[model samples]
Target chain A: MARTQGSHSEITGPRVREAAMRLFARHGFAAVSMRQIATEVGVQAGALYNYTPDKQSLLFDLMREHMDALLDAWQQEDPGGTDARARLEAFTRFHIRFNTRRADAVFVSYMELRNLTGENFAAVTELRRIYETRLEEILRAGQDAGVFTLAEPRITAMAVIALLTGVNTWYRDAGRLKLDEVETLYWDMVRRLVGG
Target chain B: MARTQGSHSEITGPRVREAAMRLFARHGFAAVSMRQIATEVGVQAGALYNYTPDKQSLLFDLMREHMDALLDAWQQEDPGGTDARARLEAFTRFHIRFNTRRADAVFVSYMELRNLTGENFAAVTELRRIYETRLEEILRAGQDAGVFTLAEPRITAMAVIALLTGVNTWYRDAGRLKLDEVETLYWDMVRRLVGG
Candidate 1:
């Protein structure tokens, strides 16, 4: 019976997470309740507890999963053997491509951070720092190779991340530019920003 | 008498707005109640209604005031007669300086925007656009004068605003870099971004 329940959760868990992220993005974490999430997922409030302990855990799980996926995806896409310029371009395009597709997750990740518990928040921050450090490493390599000129690699990494991530706030699929064109435009901007 | 009550409100209205902004910044708009704001202001819930009709209005009022103050300050600081590069640097530094000073207002302005009614949201967006247009105009002016090379002024303006506004997300007074240093670094990035 426990094995069977685990199998069931493998299916329902993602559904619950999807519902929770949507509601949290729309109504905010503090305003959203477990019952509402249950209603959205077509489960009783009691049954929802089987998947997650409470709303805080639900939120933390969502954010943790987001960070985990982000870091994992970047790890796969990272061009470990490439030169600094090539690696920086890959990271730039990958961030915009990945984040634009998951707008809600990105929004919730940035907005609801204050609602997380101290330990949960620290974990999320660590994951975020790991991601930042990836880009920082690219900058450091470029600086060492004299391909990129920046006063500080860490600060440039943060600024570059902010610039790329800001794309989600205004991008539209139906807009004039295609995603490829946007990637190019942003790449040009970032390339110039670091004196590439 | 109506005149006496109006006179009383004149003094308390700012206090009420200050309390609402603080509470809304601490807890989200949906999570905070009028009673809490009233208590923060040392007034009864019923008395709070005298200044603003409801919670939504209070939120709208706070956002409106923030935007208004932002635009007004930028207007006074805007070097209308200067060239595009000079104007851009002024806007960049002024934005960082002004927004960093009013962190609460900036936080609520970005976070609680979803809680606003359609009309209120539209109003705030309009104010925000007006501000964006100020930067876009400078970009356009630069492009037209053969000084700044950019494909799209509007998108570049949005990107620049995101880059500048992002300082508030990570900047700390006790950190190594002073605010002026930050402004200079960002100005360098922006100047290069536009090929200035």
Candidate 2:
């Protein structure tokens, strides 16, 4: 029984998350049910409890994982150097690329924040603030070096992130501009915004 | 009977819309039901049908009205001179102010786009494009007059709008910054972005 349950868990865990993410992105957290998720995952509704305690937990887990992956990916992609300009450019391109590829997760993360319980909301909010701080630190470093001009580093960081993430709204791979072209266009704008 | 029905609608129509907007903004369109909206409006579920055919119509009407009001407000607020720089500044401040004032409508318009049916989505998308074109025209005029440096005016317009609309996510009337100060900060960023 232990061996059978272990195998089932391994196979269904990722499937459950993928299904939840897809459904939540499509219909939103408040609208989607455990039954609907189970239907999507090809599992009995009772089987889903073995994986997640409730829909809120599932939503929180998805949001937390999205943030964790984003931070992790940025860490790996960080062109570790003292040059703030280069780091900002790297960040611009990286954010647009990462978010466009995971549009569903990005949409879910942004749209479902109100549905989270207070404690869960706080946890996800902190994770998001940590991610935002990554860019804020870069901006501050640049300010310290006199490499960037800004009235407020923190606000600039938020604006820059918003600009980059906005790409996911209308960007299509089949659209007129290629991904690199989009990145370069945004990079140029960011460079100007920061006076880099 | 006709006079009584007219009087009831005159009072209940706006209430129904207000409740729907508040609920949809809080819980998302897909999660909200006409019954729930009616309950919030102090009406029967069946009475909601007297106001809107269905939830999709309500969502679409809310979005359309938001966009229409946005466009109309900008039209009224436009500086309307040949100076692209002045016009762009007006747009930056105007967008931030207007959107922040109607945070719930803005949230619903963006977050519930996926919930809109195809025809409704297209209608809203067209309206949004028209609004974006307002900014794009400013960018293009700036570029034409050598007042703004832009690789793509359309993309720059979208970026600026996103950056301005982002203020709604964090701005509060009781926050440290006054509305005018926030507007000036964003206007400065917009100037830098456009090379004005």
Candidate 3:
């Protein structure tokens, strides 16, 4: 019975989170409710409590998971080397590729940031700062190697991240540029911006 | 009576928009109701119809006004000259300054776009494209003059705008950098970005 219940929760947990993300992304977080999320998951309203304590928790979980996954994915993708330029290129490509595939999550992560509670907001913000620090470190290392010229490593990292993420605003599979071409173009621009 | 009615609407009209913008920025457009907006404006729910037909109209009007204002402001600020580099500099500074002052409208303009009707979305998108085209024109001119190195003028325009507008995400009045310093930093980056 314990094994069956454990298996049931493992399946239901992700479904609940997925449904919540879809609904929250479609409508804003404040507009979506636990009842609506439960409905979307084909469960009773009361059953949602088994997965998340409330709607805020669901939103926070979605955002936290998105950040955590981003950090983890970048960790796995980072081609650590003494060459900061190559690592910066890897990051530019990885950010655009990873974010475009998870457009809805990215959208929710940005749009619903204002809706997170104070504590949740801080948690997500800190995670994002850590991600930005990773890019800053690359820019700083490049500067140290005299391969890049930058006035502010932290600001440049933020600007570069925003520029890459902006791809999601207009990118479509049927669009003129393929993902690979888009990544290359942005990477080139980034390289130029950093004087690398 | 005509003069009084005209004056009343003129005053109430801005008040209504301001209140709606505040509420929409704080809570998502989908979550804010006509009643709540009316309460915020110190008017009866029905009276809001005198200004805007409905919430959708209010949202579209706010977004349209934001775009229109942005375009007008840029036109006024554009230091027209044959020098593409100088023009690009002006645009970099202008965009950062204009957007930071109207953070709420900018936030709503981005966040509530998905909530707009199809027709409204297209209309706002066209206006945004016009704004972007303004930047693309500068990049193209720079490219023609052999001053800026760019593989894609349009894409670079989009990326530059994203980079500049990103100032809104973290800028605060009490931040370490004054507005002038921030603008200078970004302008330098933009110059590097275009190879100007």
Question: lDDT tens string, model 2, B30-99?
Answer: 8888888877876667666877888888888999999999999999999988999999988988999898
TM-score of structure candidate 3:
0.95
Tens-digit lDDT string for candidate 3 (B49-162): 887888999999999999999999999989887799999999999999999999999999988899999999999999999999999999999999998888889889999998
Residues A1-196 of candidate 2 have per-residue lDDT tens digits of 2234445565367799999999998988988999999888766777788889999999999999999999999999989789998999999999999999999999999989998999989999999898889999899999899999998888888899998999988999999999999999999999999887
DockQ of each: 0.72, 0.81, 0.78
- In model 2 chain B, the worst 10-residue window by lDDT is B1-10
Which numbered prediction scores highest in lDDT against the true structure?
A: 3
How many steric overlaps are in each model, in order? 0, 0, 0
Q: In model 2, state the lDDT of residue A47.
A: 75
| Model 1 ranges with Cα > 4 A deviation | A1-11, B1-11
Best-to-worst order by DockQ is 2, 3, 1
Report candidate 1's interface RMSD in Å.
0.8
Highest-scoring model, TM-score: 2
Give candidate 3 misplaced runs (Cα > 4 Å): A1-11, B1-11
Q: Write the per-residue lDDT of candidate 1 for residues B28-90, one digit (tens) a residue.
A: 889899988877876667777777789999899899989999999999999987499999999
Question: Residue A186 in model 3: shift from native, Å?
Answer: 0.6
